[model samples]
Target: MTAAKVLVAYGTKNGSTAGIARTIADALGEQGLRAEARPAAEVLDPSPYDAVVLGGALYAGRWHRDAVRFSRRHRRALSGRPVWLFSSGPLDASANKRDIRPVPGATRASMRLNAREHITFGGCLQEGAKGAVARMIVKRGGGGDYRDAGQIRAWALGIARELTDVTGGP
Candidate 1:
């Protein structure tokens, strides 16, 4: 039998969220599933995949617009399959230290889509980050990469286990 296809879609401004998505996709792929990470804006359809992991970066305590729009646009298809949601934002180790809840928009999306799970991962902001505030944060020595790769990989592997059980492997 063929492996199940999974899509790890994300919305990011400075590309940190994209990195998280890639990590997730890689972990899922290692578990025998076919997974790919893509920008949320570029994905017009979620129907082609057996499962989807949607994520967005948080700005001003809100989810990225592209991710919100993607969830809205593909609500039907996404709802029909197993779906997971995540938010990346928190330029500190707080996410690694504790469970950070999703922002309002992601919470609503989770409820609407009946998402299997929602997680909040640490964000990253480094030199050359876009926007005045980001640059300022970096200049003041307040910015750094806070994403935990091991945590991300563990989460993705958990999802892979669940999906594999449901789909009878892969």
Candidate 2:
């Protein structure tokens, strides 16, 4: 039997969300799934994967535009798969401390795709990040890498287990 192929697609600002997506892909691969990470904007099709993990970076309580468009653009293909959604924002410890609900955009996408789950991970802002607001945050010393790699890996592993259980593959 063949292993399930998973897509870890993300929309990111300052590249932090992309990092998380890569981590997820790596973890899923470690669990015996074939997973790849790609920018949400670059993926023209979602039908090739058995499962999809879609994520976006949040700003001002909104998900990234690319992620939003991806969900709308590939709704038909995605709806038929086991889909998971995530938001990467909250540039503080709050995300680790509590369960941060999805932004309105993510919530709507989840509903539209019948996503299996949604998560909000801590965001990162640092020097050299694009945009005036990001630079300002960094200048004010409010920027840092807050993503928890362990948590991200655990999430991906859970997905791997679910996928493997259903597929009867390693």
lDDT of all predictions: 0.94, 0.92
- Count steric clashes of candidate 2: 0
Q: Write the per-residue lDDT of candidate 2 for residues 81-169, one digit (tens) a residue.
A: 89999899888989888998888999999999899999999999988999999899999999998999988888888899899899998
- Residue-wise C-alpha lDDT for candidate 1, range 52-150, written one tens digit per residue: 999999999999998899888999888679999999989999999999888899998898788999999999999999999889989999889999999
Best candidate (score: lDDT): 1
The TM-score values for the models, in the order shown, are 0.98, 0.98
lDDT of 2 at 29: 93
RMSD in order of candidates: 0.7, 0.7
